[model samples]
Target: MSAFVAEPTTALEIESIGNGTGLWLPPEVRDEVERVQSGTSAAELTAGVVELRNLIGGSADLFHAAMLALMCGTMVEHGAEPGAAIDATLDLLVATLNTLAEDPDEMARAASRLSIPAAMTMLARSKETRKRWRARPEIMDRLEALEDADLAPFWLREVFTLHDDAPLLVLDPNNRRAFEFRLIGVRDRLYHCYALLQDALLRHTGPGYLGAEPVDPLAVRYARNDHLTPADYRAATTLGDHQRFAFAYPGIAFMPGSGTPAELPTVDGVPLLTVSPKTIHFNWRPANMYGVIHEALGSSIDLIRELSPADAEALLSRCALP
Candidate 1:
């Protein structure tokens, strides 16, 4: 009977929830605001107050600026000095917008609490605030000229590239230089965080999936088992076979009449066999593998299961071992 070795299959289930804010706010906040704005009576104003309270309840930053604006407008109507309150509310609004801009996740969370028109209104207001900050004529010319790709010393660039999603602040020199340096120190911590995230993801996937430590060269043996004889299996398990199974030993080959096998060579003796069985060899000067390890590892078995017979056969043929 012909030997049949089943290749291990992976079931990668990726569940991507709808995290996109898509430049829109919620409808409930919008509807209530509209109802309040339409009525002119004092009772309508009271109703508007109640609606605003409900709208801004869970959001401290959003609600604070909104309520402060309404209070300032009310104070102006009652002949009170509303300038200070308006200025404070404007500052708060600007701070909130800056926080949102620096963090896409925060922006997404805030978007869910607001309506599209409200978001637009807030953005417009923020643009006005940013204009005020710009009017001071204190700009970080060096930072402005620095390209995103060119921002760093080698180590810093590597850290930043690895943790692209981390928040970065380009500080004004006039501000507390020491505090800014401290923040920069925090940015240094992100490299460790990125490594931790990678490790966690790999562990979640399983051993050998991601951040597992590289195999120790000293610990690795040339032969997988004692069953492998001296010469019989050695010929079949050449440099090519060693490279392909560097991560894990490929099964030993048996001689026709020997009825036994030889020791598999250690990866050092045959570096070329470190190649994976999934690798597709190309004839190009610099050989290319058809699919990446991540793509192969992350493919859904369910999708494969649903594939038609012809399509499945074609896929198998395309990815056939060389």
Candidate 2:
């Protein structure tokens, strides 16, 4: 006996003669993808996503269905190897869903595992900020305690008055550290970040983009907490401009600005428009997705780019989508 169940055919379902143990799709999803890709209007894409969420309605299968539909739908549009990408993404989703079904605690456990590196990266990104953060012994204590406990993603709101659980990234109209604040909004942005990352790896920066020099995948790790100093923050602009790359943290993604060394300017660099943070000055879209690829694989693109085909496959195998 199979676990597959069939619901009445909606615009999304195709006529099936018998049971197929795979994901189901809603019609609106494919419609919106085609619309958006055809330049019908990017806003239509949001409507499609909304429909998927509506369908989710708290069921795991529905959630997987929506994700699968979106993953395959989007990959078909931009992927270099759509079939392989779809299979990989679907497998990851199925494995995760199975874990969730068996143990609901798994999501939190996974989130906890991701929390330390993410928290450390945020704390270490800028010198002035790091000093302020370090002076707060209470905050430091919490981070230290995280070594023994799973990282509670919501804990960020305690230290930063700016943090919130809002799904979309919002800039503080009054705060100067607005960009930094957006990074803490991982409550709703985390999974979306993963989705965007998957899309980029399969379509934009994968094997097709391999360069003459093979890159090492292991070189990508969480930015070291004690490594970045005031000097690094000052010189960061030069570094960012020289490479023209963006960096992805837990919930936020940003581009390096070109300007005075002391004053590091930033632009929104996340590829997905829905989750992109809006500063008072501008809204960002997917100008470059390579940074996300770097963040997702927990390795730098330069390093991954340097690997031969076989080595690259081996490196990608090590990536943990969870």
Candidate 3:
């Protein structure tokens, strides 16, 4: 959960990011540009996933810290204040990386079993507040503010994009020709976009730079409801709006829930609001959005935010990870 500010942040309408151009990559990242220019087959994609993970796995610690900002970025999409969202990121990492890499679901379930700080549980039980996995904006500003944060595949302009008008690709301009990031913007394209972004990021940068990528707007498919477990269903029903099962309660459960702003079962953790079982269900749900798309409008995350944590490791692994 980010901070549960008494007042919600104004939803800024971010029409665009990048200066009609993208951030610069060392000319060395050209291999990724070449990779994008060449198309990928399903087999290549599968193999690529395995390959990238092995590369990133080399620099685990820095990767973990860099990932912290990313983890919180989605929390904002989950309708959390920037503060609460960041706090939740730290809490989710409390379990060792081994626990997370092996079985995030089990780790989450176990964390859920821990009593939410007294205030959060009290508010949740009393129907005073609940957290929801909806989208919001201030997190972008928070992102730009992360000066000391590590570098990764993430781009603030891309993440801030809310419509088709926003810049679609973080291009590599060389030889007076633009190497664009391309993808077929289908409603259900899966998390591989993130993997590619990870590739782009870590590829030239290496795991040392948080890894980089092959080019093209890549996407993957998921098994039906693979993100939903029996535990997820139970938690969703228990904490989310019973009437709208698809509408996940994002962020921590102690805030305003998904109801309305006037609602008030809000609670904060040691420094901010914490992650709850409700949150585990949200993250486990396959609702993460790709940063780039052919058409932002009418695509999967046009109006709402979809926070995905995909990387080659996630693509290669079949485990339930958030």
Candidate 4:
């Protein structure tokens, strides 16, 4: 479904999401839009985009991030928000993103749908930020203004980016650049149900947050080598203000950050919280689930030997998975 009318119920995450302090705005977009839009007449700007589109022979995803952003801006001007397109889709995207097994690139189409909604949220934030800047002249110099006084900058900045080497945008108006990172969707939003597990994993680490080592032998076998050891993401902030979204990965539905969903799969003695990452994504093996075993077993993780055989079985059981 493109966007849902009935919203699914979900439990709340424990600690509210945290963010690294920085400008939410992506600068490349801001600069390029400012360059093209300023000085150049509006007609010239549209002509340039049309020229660029003709030059770029192909685009992988169904939509263009820049155009989608522009469309969002246009909608705002008409006094409407993307509405359910955002509210319903955003929740589904976030949950899908949390899965352990999903293709990032395949998620492109779904991710593209989120552009307008996400843009609206950003526009609202931008307006408040701008309001503050106007009220206090002392801080105006420190602020980064995307557009002169219009809402277009908030949406178009990321689309009309200038980076030649950045892997994310994949926007090659001229066909000279080599392909790099091929995201299923725009960097900020979830593309498919599997939007950002690795992204979800990156956040839910460190002492209390907890990440597993794919300790299950079957799980270890299926996991990609790249994911086993966490990479030091120089730019973890790509999700932008969306970072506040709870546990954006798949497999484990109930994170300490996000509490348990009301409906769970087969529970022999306890609540099934974790799903076998390998099985769910592949859809070939027996659907296996783990109970809220980590806490039930008395400690975080001491040893498998310590648990009785029956207790272990109860900890992990076959069940329906998302």
Candidate 5:
């Protein structure tokens, strides 16, 4: 229901596979990787349901080897530097593959199909790699110009105050510029990947129970004068709250051999999006990436423009998580 944009989820491609260097992928693994990398978006993974089953039932060594090969190849193709950037990416790939290897179908149903916390942590590490790049005076000038141009709408507002009122994870205005850009990139990547994974689950399982890994719930609060009843509070914490609600259209029906009967339907309470975190409460869908970001990072672009590259870098260095 939220408006958002997304990029394609690019699958990593491996050129060679082996236990050691100069090794080549076995015939079966090579075919699978090639088929997957060619055009199959992760969202379209359902199309490969047969292939997934085959891989799962096949030799574990072959599957792991193929995945590692793809990852290593993708790294080489991108010419990714051998530091934190490449390392973090490989780690995520490893974790994803390992989870899949353990139980392909179960994990396939998971929201994000990997880990959100790990992604945030890796995002912080990736930001660190850009420290020197953000310190450049030209980049700082660019940051200032961006604030003046793209963020003109927010120029009159106080940066921190605005951020405090919003759900976005934003850098302090005094932080470095590169970190903000990296954060944006990482956010986009996370959203796209998760969407692909969620889509895959939907396609494979249809409109049934698609279980998700638990995540932090967005704290939705009501304001004064917004009437709240005990039922509303109870419903908010219960699984029943996941149901979508809307105003009913009034209508009347004529009764046979009798006068017209007026139908009055009484609707109770206001509609709100709610979710219970962890199994202690109830089973409900996790918030989609767009919803999470929409709640957390509203007007984040405007806020980022206020930050100097130096200030952004410093802020990132101090944070353990994004």
Candidate 6:
């Protein structure tokens, strides 16, 4: 009998398994393309092509809803959905619409050709939310003066289709205030972390603890300790910029000027604990790094309080710093 023969797999064949198609771009490349294509300065044709590619290859329903909310001021104005995703999208739309309504420049641009009654009708019906959108008196006056016939259909469509949760008018005598209590709660937790980190760094950097704390413990226990010789202090201070680039730590989001110890002459006594979009600045002097860790632990504690004991324990265990 003749021996069976098998065809060899080429690189192209190997690449096809997870690639979805021969045309699929790698994730990193796709991300770069997305970043570039999002820019408005690109040629309309090129931008349209990129947008089409993104809609086809990198689609996310939440993202599409968000875009529609920003541009049209209402998710339902575009289309509708059901279930948890719909609810979440509506919430996001409300948030974004609220932001736009609050901004005078943006509101002006959006309502330039819209009439008050039409706008109010849109607000009332969209999202079925009844919150009033209030603006500065001057903007309101301008909106009130516009005639219905002069209004633009697109502008009216965008305005009326916003989520019901949007803040439309403070003119209503019975309007309730909308505040994000959760953000306040989070801020309190963050402040507690800062204080704990500050205290821990102060204690660890003192001469007594430095003499007795083992090197590993000293490093971990006093990871953020910034008190050192003048030369060492400078060196440690320099690490602030580099620490922002560290990938191992993901829980903390650093703000450029936030994490720095506030008392420095250069910083005008502001703490170096700024929160930025991508990073949290640990700008505290090296002597204060331990303090920051303590602060982080405190913040973690606050967060854990919101979870079940089992989940909290798991999170704490995972947060153990090396």
Clashes of 5: 13
Model 1, C-alpha of 32: deviation from truth (Å) = 4.6
Q: Which ten residues in a row have the lowest lDDT in candidate 4?
A: 291-300
Report the Cα lDDT for candidate 6.
0.28
**Highest TM-score, which number?**
2
Q: Which structure among the candidates has the greatest lDDT?
A: 2
- Indicate the residue-level lDDT of 6 in model 6: 20
lDDT of each: 0.26, 0.29, 0.26, 0.26, 0.27, 0.28
Work out the TM-score per prediction: 0.20, 0.22, 0.19, 0.17, 0.20, 0.17
lDDT of 1 by residue, 1-322 (tens): 0010011111110011133322222366445445555546545554544444343433334433343345334433333332323334444444443344445353323422232223222222232332343322122232222224232112211111121212211111111110000111111222222222223323333455322443222111111111323452353243111111112122422111111111223222311011122232111110011111110011110000123445434433333311
What's the distance in Å from true for residue 31, model 1? Answer: 6.7
lDDT of 6 at 142: 35
Per-residue lDDT of 1-322 in model 6, one digit per residue for the tens? Answer: 0010022223442344235453234467456545533534324323433333233212232222233222222221223211212323334433333434455343232322122222232243333232233233433333333323332222323232122221111000011111111110011122223333333332423433212222232232233232334454455444322222211122443323233222211112211222112233343433332223211111111111123445434433444321
Global Cα lDDT for candidate 4: 0.26
Instruction: Tally clashes: model 6.
Output: 49
Which has the higher lDDT value, candidate number 2 or candidate number 4? 2
Worst 10 residues of 3 by lDDT: 240-249
1 or 3, greater by lDDT:
1
Candidate 3 at residue 27, lDDT? 51
After superposition, which runs of candidate 5 have C-alpha atoms over 4 Å from their true positions? 1-23, 40-301, 304-322
Better of 1 and 5 by lDDT: 5
Q: Please write out the lDDT profile of model 3 over residues 1-322, one tens digit for every residue.
A: 1111112211220111112232223355435533522324534433432332233223233222222233223223333333332334333323322333344443222232221221122221221111221122333343243323321114322322322211122211111111123222222222322322333333333343211222222121221122344554454342311111111122333332223222212212101111111222222222333322211112321111211334323321322213
Candidate 5 lDDT tens digits, 1-322:
0000011111121122111233244467566555644533433332332232233223233223233333333333333222323333334434443444345442221311222222222222243333323324432333344345432122111111111111122222222222111122222222222222223323332443224432222212211102434553454453111211111111311111111112212222211111111133222322322222211122212122324556545544544213
